[model samples]
Target: MSRLVEATTAEPANPEPVFLDFSSVQVATASYLRESVLAFRDLVRGRRSTFYPVIANANDDVRDELKELMRLRGDVLMVCTLGPAGDVNMARLIGDLDPKQRMTFDLVHEHGETDAGELMRAYGESEGLKHTTAWNNRLAALAARGLLMEVSQGRAKRYRPLFEDA
Candidate 1:
């Protein structure tokens, strides 16, 4: 642990987000995970928010163990994929988002880019949303969470899934 900390101390002041690509790594034990990753996480502590130490291409067992860690520790670990599509824990991913934000995120994720009007119409029949501003706010909230992106279309806005430039 001390050696790991010593090595980490030499990391660049503004370190790039670490990507733990597990494509080649097939197996791991909980002991090694605790010794390496948990220790690293503790060493870094909280000098950041959002993406860092992202694990990608983790197999089912590894992902499950990481999920267990997250459940117990209550800390989020971002996951990255080589391509755009991948699965993540939607409930964990949507932390603190209200119903509208959740719905907006779902809509955007399901259908690529969605305009406010389209979203409003989709839910309008059920929710009685007559004004456009409410839908805008919902999409904006999702965008703020980095789950969605806002694009300009003439005088309107469209929300799309936040695709990382992997």
Candidate 2:
């Protein structure tokens, strides 16, 4: 785990998606996955690290292990397929996202980029969100989980989908 963390530390110091490709791995134990993948994500994101890690090309067995681990942890991660040009061809979330977070994620995905106040006005009534604070908390939570990219515009923070077409 420490070695994996150390290896990732040498990544370029710029904000970008870091793909952790697992095309060769046929199997991975839950404890190993948790210690390496999950721990690396937590440590990097906790430090406000520049790179966002995305799992790629994981086989069914590895994916299953990760899904179970994430379900137990109540956290989520992005799993994606890279295109020939190294673009995200498709992406999905693993683990479980509560209804509210899922809703927030869908809203951001559909709208492109938005802020809490905007969501409050557009979805507050229909979504049972009465105040901007509620929307803000949801967006903040998604950002913390590495599902959304949080950007600052003056005093207000806006969030957008980390993947263009996830």
Q: Cα RMSD (Å) per model? A: 8.4, 2.1
TM-score of 2: 0.88
Instruction: Give candidate 1 misplaced runs (Cα > 4 Å).
Output: 1-78, 81-96, 163-166
Best by lDDT: 2
Question: Model 2 Cα displacement at 65 (Å)?
Answer: 0.9
Estimate the TM-score of every prediction: 0.46, 0.88
Give the best candidate by TM-score: 2
Per-residue lDDT tens digits for candidate 2, residues 1-46, read 6766777776564456778888888999988888788788878778
Off by over 4 Å in 2: 7-14
Candidate 1 structure quality by residue, lDDT tens digits, 1-166: 5654564564554323444567777776767766776666545544322323546667778867766765665444545554445443221241234566666666777888788788777877677778778888877655443345456567877766544321
Candidate 1, number of clashes: 0
